[model samples]
Target: MISIELFAIGLVLKGPEIPWWLLALVIATGQIGGKLLHYYAARGSIRLPPFLRRKSANERTGRWREYLEKFRANCHRRPVWTGAVLLISAASSLPPFAAVAVIAGWAKVPLVTFLVTGFVGRFVRFGALAIAPGIVIGWL
Candidate 1:
């Protein structure tokens, strides 16, 4: 949910003071770690607060849950497509990776699939962001 682009760009601008790949790895690790927590929470491995549970049962939440159920059905029927969506969300944040994580967890997506896709996507995303400044400066 939080945007870390500025921080990553700042690290890149440090000009060899920090390794870009290392920065990308650290950022990706933290991002995936947080998403994993969301996944576990949605998977029922972590207990959510009572208020959250109550809110989730509301009409609005119910509607969203219904939609998510459909998505889960599709995930089972089309795993490769689901993985592609997850990868895109993880890398681009277009559909919001946090929401995707929750959806994947609720869908009971294989843990290995979630972790591997998430890490690879996040690494690529952050790595690109970290390197962008240098590439642009080179152009200038």
Candidate 2:
């Protein structure tokens, strides 16, 4: 967790030499941290902090109800996939973090699944960015 925070700090500081190990460390930390946030919300141990608690949470919860209409659902069904999707969305800024995290919490998405999915999603996304640059640059 601290390492992830440090990564963010390093980004802000414009420091060089973000090691490969730190990159993996941060992604793993971020995924786990995101899952814990959802779990705590589900367990009722924590209240949504002011930024996270709002009409948005309720709105997303309502949206999840709509998703449930399709079939029986629980947090565990595709933890890795769901986590990947949510984290990918968050990482890519496709959806607001609060919407993703809060709805995921209410949906009871299992910790393990989300962690796996989110990790893979983030890994693939980042990995693609790392690996595809040469191919992309060549096309230009």
Candidate 3:
């Protein structure tokens, strides 16, 4: 159960331990969660189930889709690297997290591109604590 949660959470939450396998598991969950959210949102005025749509459209995810369009526009201006950075930055955006990763994957971003950049960002975020205990402890 924890592994599953870890995987789901890892897509957004920064943490340590929680094996790669667990992260992968959470990634799957996150993807499913996002797809479900998009499905419900686009389905009608329903726009996500009660538990999912926390903020008003003018406030949160309504803005998220707009941002995604902008990001894609920028991607067209450059290339995959542009998306990688945009996506990497988005890791910190949504509270439900994994909004970008799952969305990107759902957008059918090449598996290799998403994994390389997403994992790189995830690990960099993870490294601050997940690996560099000596640095973190020294700060403490």
Candidate 4:
């Protein structure tokens, strides 16, 4: 997510000109829409770009595949944990939500779980950001 740009927009829209929830909803919608594309690509429902595909059977690609396999196995074993991680990533961007989106897709997380968690988390995140400027200014 473009944190700086969102925060700046929140600052500009700090007053009653626009509701914070509306701004949050719009941003969350866009973020989840893009992430859904990534999820589908990883699920093989959508084609991946050439750069994302393996061009050669190199050591790096091999290692990455192995790592992904392990991750996939873990996801299958502990789906709730995986969903929790996705929620956290969406909310705080602690581990980068884009990477998590790919992982969730590859791991075959249920579409409902992905959409619900991602949307709720993103809504919370952007809503807080949208209101932050107003709150801070009120304290001043």
Candidate 5:
């Protein structure tokens, strides 16, 4: 399968065709791969630059730690809704997927939940995008 640009062109102009399911699969896989990479990077950033990992309770890092703890607590309180929003954001590309992934990682979302949500969201998003051109053409 080709890129999003080419896929869009194919949808709009009726260019070369691959089954819609295959295109959706490829796009979803690519999206999830990028998302996972972003998540891991955010997780790893906690240890980055020793200066930012201070142990002092009064330091800036300590404040960051407190904020993360509160966020984690919120996540625990509304795990299902949080995950649903994350999935919807990923699928719709709203509020930016990278930002959401980083937040999820920083909040320590379960790996399985993150992966599953990301995959489902990405698949649905790409599938909808793939069909959008046809819908517009029909309306026109």
Candidate 6:
């Protein structure tokens, strides 16, 4: 999503004018859809025999385990923190949304919660970008 943020901002700054609400809506929809796909993909992979297989000694697999462990711990012991983390991940570039969404899915966060938070966060994120040029130019 960060990959496309700059381009969206550039369009807002240099291309034809677009309503901020429309831009934010479109961006939020695309981002949420992308994240949902990522979540389901992660869920599906976990259900696969190969993915559920015993962990190997590979460094990459080790790192993945660490991520999952942290995710599980956060979900169980610090649900508020997990929610904040997910919200921040949705709203910003730090802690890639794909990873966060996958973890959320694995942690069994309710689908309604995921979608609502994701949509709201993404709306704010893209809304900020969409209006940045206006703010900078004192047009808003």
| Highest lDDT against the true fold, candidate | 1
TM-score of each: 0.89, 0.50, 0.41, 0.84, 0.74, 0.76
lDDT of each: 0.89, 0.56, 0.49, 0.84, 0.77, 0.79
Model 5 per-residue lDDT tens digits across residues 27-125? 889888988877876777435566645476566466767887887788779889778978898888787887889888878888888899889988888
Per-residue accuracy of model 1 over 49-102 as CA lDDT, tens digit each = 887775543564567768888998999899899889989999999899999999
lDDT of 2: 0.56
**Tens-digit lDDT string for candidate 2 (27-94):** 65666586567656854668866776666555645665678533225335655556656767655646
For TM-score, the strongest prediction is 1
If the candidates were sorted by their TM-score against the true structure, best first, what order would they fall in? 1, 4, 6, 5, 2, 3
lDDT of 1 at 126: 96
lDDT of 4 at 96: 88
Better of 1 and 4 by lDDT: 1
lDDT, candidate 6, at 51:
60
Give the residue spans of candidate 5 off by over 4 A.
1-16, 45-68
* Model 3 lDDT per residue over 18-114, tens place: 5644554445445445444443344343444577554554554577678776765665576666555634553433333345544554344544555
Model 6, range 40-103, lDDT digits (tens) per residue? 7666643546765447556545776787877777687876676777788889856887778987
| C-alpha root-mean-square deviation, each candidate | 2.2, 6.4, 8.2, 2.5, 4.4, 4.0
lDDT of 3 at 8: 41
Q: Which stretch of 10 consecutive residues in model 6 shows the poorest summed lDDT?
A: 45-54
lDDT per residue as tens, model 4, 1-140: 45654564655565556788888898899999999999999889998789988687665456778888988898889988888988999999888888889888988988988999999988988888877777877999
